[model samples]
Target chain A: MALRVGVVGGGQLARMMIAPAVELGVELRVLAEAEGMAASAAATAVGDYRDAETVVAFARDVDVLTFDHEHVPQEVLAALVDAGIPVRPGPGPLRFAQDKLAMRARLAELGMPQPDWAAVAGADDLGAFLAAHGGRAVVKTPRGGYDGKGVRVVRDPDDAADWFEAAQGAPLLVEELVDFSRELAQQVARRPSGQMRAYPVVETVQRDGVCAEVIAPAPHGGDRLSAVAASIGTAIAEGLDVTGMLAVEMFETTDERLLVNELAMRPHNSGHWSQEGAVTSQFEQHLRAVLDLPLGTAEPVAPWTVMVNILGGPEVGDIDGRFAGVMSEHPSAKIHTYGKASRPGRKVGHVNVSGFDLDDVAYEARAAASHFD
Target chain B: MALRVGVVGGGQLARMMIAPAVELGVELRVLAEAEGMAASAAATAVGDYRDAETVVAFARDVDVLTFDHEHVPQEVLAALVDAGIPVRPGPGPLRFAQDKLAMRARLAELGMPQPDWAAVAGADDLGAFLAAHGGRAVVKTPRGGYDGKGVRVVRDPDDAADWFEAAQGAPLLVEELVDFSRELAQQVARRPSGQMRAYPVVETVQRDGVCAEVIAPAPHGGDRLSAVAASIGTAIAEGLDVTGMLAVEMFETTDERLLVNELAMRPHNSGHWSQEGAVTSQFEQHLRAVLDLPLGTAEPVAPWTVMVNILGGPEVGDIDGRFAGVMSEHPSAKIHTYGKASRPGRKVGHVNVSGFDLDDVAYEARAAASHFD
Candidate 1:
């Protein structure tokens, strides 16, 4: 009786899980989007995840079904659950991550701190909400928005008219633009049996709304911020009955209060620093939690850890060719690549550096990551 | 072009190399002994290492050829080199690891410290050597012996008569049984370009000639021992012209002098602790050295780290069932399984624990490993 774990997506998140899966003696089978995808390193079945028949066939062989992303359709997820296959985070909680308006309303009901937001049906509704809150607002589509797509900053209601037309009557959300000092991410894991653990909050630097780097134990983020972040993570895990990994993306406002901004029901890019910094990586923890196994410690192993993502640049050559120079310059930096080809703005890999000195670790991580570019 | 590395064995060593190979962006292809071997996680070709044509064909696509074990028959290795395939630790040096007689002769010529030894052909030769030295001696077949096999301790020459008959005139070595307090292993990686790095000497515990545990920065091991071990490792790397990972298993006598015992020309069991304990893992270092890439730092990440091997026991069920309790109890202990099936006394996996305190780390590592047993 092999303990088989099936992952729904074969992106980098799923690819990174291969190392821990091999170490744990667990059989992992991934439903990759296509051949040569990031996670093709493991046992893979390339098929459309949107097809219920294909996804259900993949789930039939696994003890538990989980995901690399929260993009699976709700109806398809329901079929798996109805068939008695265990799906972590279930469809009920994953809907929040799928739809922005639903997440805002749920957080409000749960009495969680968030930016003032409202669901707008059209341009007229957006204009009213903008007048009531502030002149400027962030407008977003409820579904399919990620990494700056399906999102826009609006000074006037007309700016969102195109989105309303594209939505075809689906509700959209407009919220007051948050003036945050810095962005932080809190990662937490939960088992269906109620066991839970939270990692140290990390500060993330973004370029063009994409994560560029992450610093563990966020700089100047004292006990107050940590406590607030942990509380938020724990509440989300319990409130949503989420099993497996949960990432709470937060905004530390200029006034010093933390506001929840986004939610990811799987391993997030911001927690990539933990792969070298923490005793147990989030990818490993996710497997344990989803399998109802005891959770691992989320404690930091180093004083400071910095992770910089290697976004594809103009240089077109084999990545291994650059290893000699970069490795010679920064021998302690740990590099991880997704086995992906170079394409501008794509996250091809990341570098992690952990040490006693924060500045040194940060510099090494950034320098090593930039080498690929 | 991608940097392709071809390994000539499909054991756990090659399996473990897959992780680091993926991280380093090197496309690793292994010539496995059979289908479904441990290293099948990577691109693999099932072939016999003894067959020169199969091995050479396998090496055709690789930029550099290496080995997961020294058992790849010297002639086949020579053929690979003759074909202009870059083989790290070229057959000239790999001969030392393949034959004890050659290793001992070379070490003696290099003026290295070792037990008084002789190449014995028969009972008569054994008797003369035993009489000249102490009555008690250790006898071993020069080639194809591992994990206590083909080795015996004897006070009478008659004790080695059976081995002599089995050898049928193949060479054998007999050495005076050195009185040693504990065994220490120093692991070093060398590149063809003359770059080298040494890891801290670790105290190894052996059970029936198999490595059972390793404690890094050896307990109560002073600076004098560390310097001596590092020097021995450096000398061997330069003296043997060995390229890639070299493990020197030595005897730390009660009198505080070191005697060379065994040599491994690739990643060794004693270096397994480096996966969690050191800044650069021996597997990754081996890849770098073999590829002639710049080596990484071999510094220890923690003050103390303990590694305990997981020997398969009689428990006949899924190994994953035990992981829940063991991981819950010792969340920080890192477990590395070879994706092997359970069999009594087999080297199935290992556990590593690193922290500030030696006693605590040792306890956690042993306890977690015991669960599998």
Candidate 2:
């Protein structure tokens, strides 16, 4: 019998996993949120992730369970564990990604470089954190936040009055606004047997808190910075006993120091560049890690690999028709489109261009992606 | 709606297409021969390819129809065309791949390089051809032969008595065995609009007439021979009006001449290295060409890429257990399993390794594949 992997989330992450699973001779079954989710292309069971009954039933047949997103409730995860299902990035480590407050506390305990943070229960607590942190702070709800949602920057506690009300007494996380020069993302994969591998640190450009483009190997990234990023990624994966992919988003301070910004226990948008850039893609690496197989090499095939995301514009239209023109314009560009309905400001696809020349690859990637707009 | 592709066979060629299909956002529906064929991972319709109704029904839901192999009867293919369904490498071109006699005749008509050949009906005819051609010839059934089946080298007319009896007067293709130094394969993709691209010619090693390993950019292959191979591919694709991928298997004579051996109208074993070696994979290129989308670049990513097939040995056990050790030992090796049940001498999977040194890449690929044995 083939190894059956159950992924809980029907987004592009799971959709991408389908290819690797097929190549590995593993059967992939996805628990999607809806009928037409991106992962509907695979063997999927549609249901709400929060329902323990639905989740447990979905996990019944698979030999192991992993996730495409960190949104599954701990209660449902715990139930699967109780049923003796092998869940990668088990509930223990997934907790750190589920709650911002928990992640901050853990990073602080590990003596990792991070901005000053505090858990705030109300406006008074928020005021105190702001006053202590240069009169401004980044406030975020501890749970259910993603893609720039459930997050706010405030100069005064009064500016977060709506968030405080919406939290309904739940503790919110507040951190000092990071004064960084640029953003970098490091991806690492770990097997249950403790095997680990880290990809080259890449500079990620964000627009409205969403990843816009990624330049792999981070141009101008000295050996020291790359080493520091690699060490940090390795530390987090080992410390958390992560059994799959872990993405550490960091801020490279002007002082040449790195600060942890956020943690994702699953494949992140930043690692998408590895699809064509590296010998083994993050999607394939995640499957290897989850199945307790040795990790594949993370070596970049080219000197530079540039990735540009295709965001859905304000207009509603099909992206399929643009394939001919984009391919004709840049024959070497690798395009990966998610089978999703285009919505305003949504991520629908990405373009990857790899070559020896960084500037040429970056320009091609960006230019090809812009046409899809 | 996405462009739907319906493939006639459920073999590994169609199975490998699942990966590129996901990235292209193209829906692939395969008419598998059985319930658990390799391509069951996709949207499959289990039915007989010989049944015109079943094939037409499967074609109804797809935008274009293609084949994993050329075994589909000519009548069934004609039915699809008569029904207004687009079939890549349309019936006219596919006929060449289906019958050796037809292919040899067509190549001769085009003034292409080929060995001396003749069509024999029985022992008397075979004796005449053998006597005329050094008293030795390679005899083969004209239709429905693959791998090393239904082909034999005979020195006497009575040597193929059993085959002649079984054939019952059916014509057999007879040809003089050419003295060759090595075998080479060139793959090319063409779209309905006439756009074409050819991949680098590669040297192929055969074991019992089955492709065992392939080395891209055939070693010692000078620019002249490479140019000749490319032109031959282009000519065949254009002259035959073949759409999608066409693989031309050729023999390089000891005197340094290229002669046509066989033709395959879909992604063939010789092009498997393109998955990691080239900017665009044959599987992806085939989809784009068949869909009438502009084809992607066929540029090689690495200087040398070696591919070794993993044939099932004399063992009934699963090869999955060996994956961990193989991956750990060769972290850079790319493995592709077909998800088929293991049977002695069956082709279950393949391994690909790419690097600057041809010898090193070839060794690694062979070493990793042997572990599965």
Candidate 3:
């Protein structure tokens, strides 16, 4: 019998896992939230992941349990563990990833460089944050925010009051709005056997609160910055005892300070470039880590790889026909389309282009990605 | 809204199409013949391929229709074409592949080389075939046979009558058992627009009537043999007006004659190595051909790529444990498992290993593939 893997959510991450799991001869089952989600490896049971019964039933027959997202409730994870089911990147590490305040605090405790932050309860806490950050700060909710949601820029104390009300009484983390030079991400993986590997830092471009494009090996290929990012990624894997792939989102301040922005405990949107960009894809690495197998090489397949997200724009026309045209133009460009309906601002798919030259590849990747839009 | 591709069968060739269909941003759907079959790309509808209503329903939403095997009933294919649905490598070419005698007749009409063959109804036909070749002949059913099935060696004409009784009512294609030095397979892809390209001729090794391994860029790099095979493949593609990938199985006789052995109209078992062995995988090439898209590169990624089939043997009792062990042993060998149940002599999957040295890589690939067996 194959090792049964129960993924907690159903989306492209689960869908992408289908290929690698099939390649590695592992049968993957999913507790997909929807009837026709991705991850078509084995039979799927549709149910709510937060419901402990649903999760427990899904885990009961599987050899090991992993997740598609970090949103599963702590009670469900605890129940699975109590019942002797194996859950990778267990509840302890997941909690830190689930809550931004906790993640930042944990990183600070480990002597990692990060922007000065404060845990806030309400409007009163906003005043304390602004006073310490030159009358301006970035306020974010501790949980359930992604792609720039549940976040706000507060220039005045009066502005902070609206965000506090909008948060709906959720805990907030306020940080200094540093003058950052660029945004970068360090993608890493750690196995249960304590083996860890890190990829080069990637320079990221953000557009309207979502990742627009990523240039792997970063621009100019800064040796010092790459080393620091690698150390930070490795440190988090050891410090938090994370098992499976972990990606640390970072902001490079003008003064060369690498502030830890977010921690994702699975293959992230940032690592999508590695599909054809690297020798060992992040999806394959995730499987190896969770299964406690020896990690494959992480060398880049090409000198440069540029990934551009296919954000759904304001259009109701045929996206498929447009994609055909893009493929006709650049037959070598690799495109991954999620079986998703197009909605304005939604992440429909992504295109990655690789070449000996970065500028050439980035242009082709960005053009193809936005062609449908 | 991607182009929906409906494959008529649910075997590993259809399973391999999942990867390239995903990479190329096309929707690939399969009408699998059985449950738990490995076609993991798009939605699969399980039903009878021979039933018109069942097959029609599977073809309902698909833009282009193709096959996982060439054995779809002629009446069923004609009905689909009558309904104006596009079937790549359409019924015309499929007929030659479906029946060996018809294929040989067509090849003979085209002045193609072949071992002495005769269409026989009974012992009388076998008598004529054997009298010309030392009173020994090989008999085969004209249709529905592959990998040594429906084929037999007969040394006497009287024995042929008993063999005919054994075949029930199937017609026979008898050939003189020629002295063959090696076997070669030429994989080629043709677009509906008449574009075509061929990969290097690959030498295949069969053990116990099953393809055990394939050595790409066949040893000694026989340019003459390569050219003859490519010419024959292209001739067959154009002569039959094939609109998708075609793999022409050939036997290189001791006299240097390349004789047609069998034919497959889809991305076949022989071309599975092209997934990582060639620049563009056979799956991707098949998709382009069916869709009439421009052909991609067909160059080898490395100097040598050896693909070894995994045929389950008695030692397959602990398949999962063996797979894990093989992965740790050869990290570079690329193994593709079809997520299928393994019985004795069943093709579970194949492992492809590519490197600078053919001998070492071929051994490594075969070892990794056979480890589970």
iRMSD per model? 1.3, 0.7, 2.8
Task: Give TM-scores of the second chain, every candidate.
Answer: 0.98, 0.98, 0.96
Model 2, B215-280: lDDT tens digits are 998999989999999999999998888999999999999999999988999999999999999999
Model 1 DockQ vs. reference: 0.69
Per residue, candidate 1 scores C-alpha lDDT tens digits across B19-135 of: 787666678899998987777777468988999999999999799998888998888988998899999989989899889999999999999999999999899999999999868
Tell me each candidate's TM-score: 0.98, 0.98, 0.89
Q: What are the chain A TM-scores for all the models, listed individually?
A: 0.98, 0.98, 0.96
Q: For model 1, what is the alpha-carbon lDDT of residue B261?
A: 93
**Residues forming the 10-long window of minimal summed lDDT in candidate 3 chain B:** B312-321
Clashing pairs in 3: A15-A39
Against the native complex, each candidate's DockQ, computed on alpha carbons, is: 0.69, 0.90, 0.36
User: What C-alpha lDDT values do all the predictions have?
Assistant: 0.89, 0.91, 0.83
Off by over 4 Å in 1: none
lDDT of 1 by residue, A1-373 (tens): 4578999999899988877877776778999999988887774699989989899988997999999899999989989988899998799989999988989998888888999998888989988888886688999888999998888999898998888988899889888899999999999999999999999999999999999999998999888889889999999888988899999999999999999999999999998888878988999899989999999889998999999998984356645667777888989999887878788899988999999999899889989887877
State the lDDT of candidate 3 residue by residue for B53-156, as single tens digits. 78887898888999988888899999899888899989989999998889989989998888889888787777877898999888887878887787788998
Better of 2 and 3 by DockQ: 2
